[model samples]
Target: MIQIGIVGVGTVGASVARILEENQDIITARAGKEIRVRKGVVRNLSRARDVAIPLTDDVDEILDDPDIDIVVELMGGVEEPYHVVKKALEKGKAVVTANKALLAYHRYELQDVAGDLPFEFEASVAGGIPIIKALREGLSANHIESIKGIINGTANYILTKMMTEGVDFGPVLKEAQALGYAEADPTFDIGGFDAAHKLLILASIAYGIDAKPEDILIEGIEQVTQEDIAFAKEFGYTIKLLGIAKKVGEFVELRVHPALVPQREMIAKVDGVMNGISVIGDKVGETMYYGPGAGGDATASAVISDIIAIARGGKSSPMLGFKRPLESGLQLLERDAIVSRYYLRLVVEDKPGVLAKVSQVMGEQKISIETMLQRPGEGETATLLLSTHRCEERAMQQALHALFGLESVKERPVMFRIER
Candidate 1:
């Protein structure tokens, strides 16, 4: 029997305990042993939880128990979870976590600390999608070229509503929060940080890279207006917050931002609170994984899957699905180095020379406008919506800088990348 101790007993942890008990027979048969949750740790022991397992306020009881073979840290945080996981690994107990932020920063260090011990985190990325296992095992033979994903559900849900219902962001965000798709403080989910954390995990596995969240370019969906959604529809595109990682020779580019993806693409059709990831490899071409991105039962399913792997005595793979640790010498391509089509919205003075001034700045940067829209202003300013042909981000930045200096331009321009 494999005795398990779950710390946290919150939504995910409680779900893990329930699923293990409900599916005990099948899980045990598949795991080649009886997997049992001996104890669970929670802040308030008096608080009634759904799971039948004994709950305790003391974390040490589980950690100190000699019979507990595996310690599941569902606790969500950086420092305390880090210390708990570190201590659990030190005690020779196998560790499983769903904390992406903690792992994103300290994965390599934790991997070193755990050494030969099993340290599994299948649930850390996309909720129930086994993208991590697929990359680590199924596509093990191929060299990962790039990974593009709609990893966060809150942003996707908001964008979907904005596009389909023609609603603005604020109302949709409120609706999402009411539907339990978003948090009270939705910054972590809507700001692209959540997706960025997941992307860092995938990047490390695919490229052997240990890049931090601060090292990558991250843009949120706060600026995606209803007009932008309408423009995307007119151009046959869908707007989504995407976590993108691409390898160019030795250099790897990493970013999380709202993108205008082709309408026909599978990822573009993934709506509501769902997740999808498209991974390109040398041999596999392009492969996609899609499923529910978050929820108690869905995420818990993934955590239990990792537990079953441990119960079956699966060993950690040394290659870790990459050739070696990503060399620091391998340049991380800056956002400015990226080349893509762009969507630009500018509020300008409704004057004849205004267009000429904007065009001149773009001309100096050699950026060609592919499509343009002009709407008469409610007041003294008009809205100019323009799409540009493939251009370097650096050139676009330069063009925007020069355009801002123009006397005809009213406000800072809103720009979004067009993903082909």
Candidate 2:
């Protein structure tokens, strides 16, 4: 029998306890051993919990108990959890965590400390999608080319509601908070940091690259507007905040931002508080993983999966899927060096030669316009939406600068990447 100690009995922790107890026989059969939740550590013992497990206020009890074979850190913060996980590993305990922010910054350090120890964190990336296992084991033979994903459920839910109901962001965000889809302070989710954290984890595993959340280009969905949504509909595209990581000739590019995906793609069809990741590899062509991105039960399912692996005495594979060190001395590709199609919405003065001036600026930057739309101005300002052929991102930045300088262009243009 494997005895487990769970620290932080919150929603996910409670779900883990419940699932283990409810499915004890099946889990035992699959794991080849009976796993027991020996103790649970929490800040407040007085807080009512649904699970019937024994609880303790002292985390040390779990850490010091020699019988506890696995320590599950469901704690959400950085410094403290880092210390706890470090201690757990020092005691030779296998650890599992769902804290993406902590892992995004400290993965390499943790992996170094956990040398040859069974440390698993399948729940850190996409709730219950098994993406980590898929990349680490199932597709181990292929060289991963690129990954693009809709990894943040709150942003996805908000965007989906906005697209379907023509609702503004503020009301929808409030509703999401009320329904627990978003937090009281949703900056982490809405500002794209949550997705960036998850993306960094995936990038590290796929490329053996240690990337911090700050090192990547992260743009939130706060700037997505009804006009942009309308334009996407007209162009037969859906706007989603995507976490994109790609390897290009010794350089890896990582970014999380709003993207215009063609309606025909399966990833674009994933809607409403769900997650989807599309991975293109050398041999597999293109493969996608999709499921509930977040929730107590879903996340708990992943945590339990990791626990089962440990209970079954599975050896730790290379956390990043590759055993050899990734080629060193290679820099992460600058965002400006990336090349892709773009969706641009410009508020311009409704007069002759405005379109010509915009086109001229794009031409100067060597950017080709693919599709164009002009809406009648209510007053002196008109809306011009243009989709461009594939071009270097630096060229688009320069074009935006030139367009902003033009007297005919009213406001700063809204730009989003177009994914086919």
For each candidate, how many residue pairs have backbone atoms clashing (under 3 Å)? 0, 0
Query: Best lDDT goes to which candidate?
Result: 2
Q: Write one digit per residue (lDDT tens) for candidate 1, span 74-159.
A: 98988899999999999999998989989888888898888778888889999999999999988888888889999999999999
lDDT of 2 by residue, 1-420 (tens): 999999999999999999999999999999999999999999998889998889999999999999999999998988899999999999999999999988988998999888888889999988999999988888877878999999999999999999999999999999999999999999999999999999998888788887788778898989888888999998789989899999898889999989998899989998999999999989989999999989999999999999999988988886556677856544689888988999888999998998899999999999999999888766888999889999998999999999999999988988888877
lDDT of 1 at 66: 96
| Local distance difference test values of all predictions, in order | 0.90, 0.91
* Alpha-carbon RMSD to native, per candidate: 1.5, 1.6
Question: Candidate 2: RMSD over Cα atoms?
Answer: 1.6
Candidate 2 structure lDDT: 0.91
Residue pair clashes in candidate 1: none
Candidates in order, TM-scores: namely 0.97, 0.96
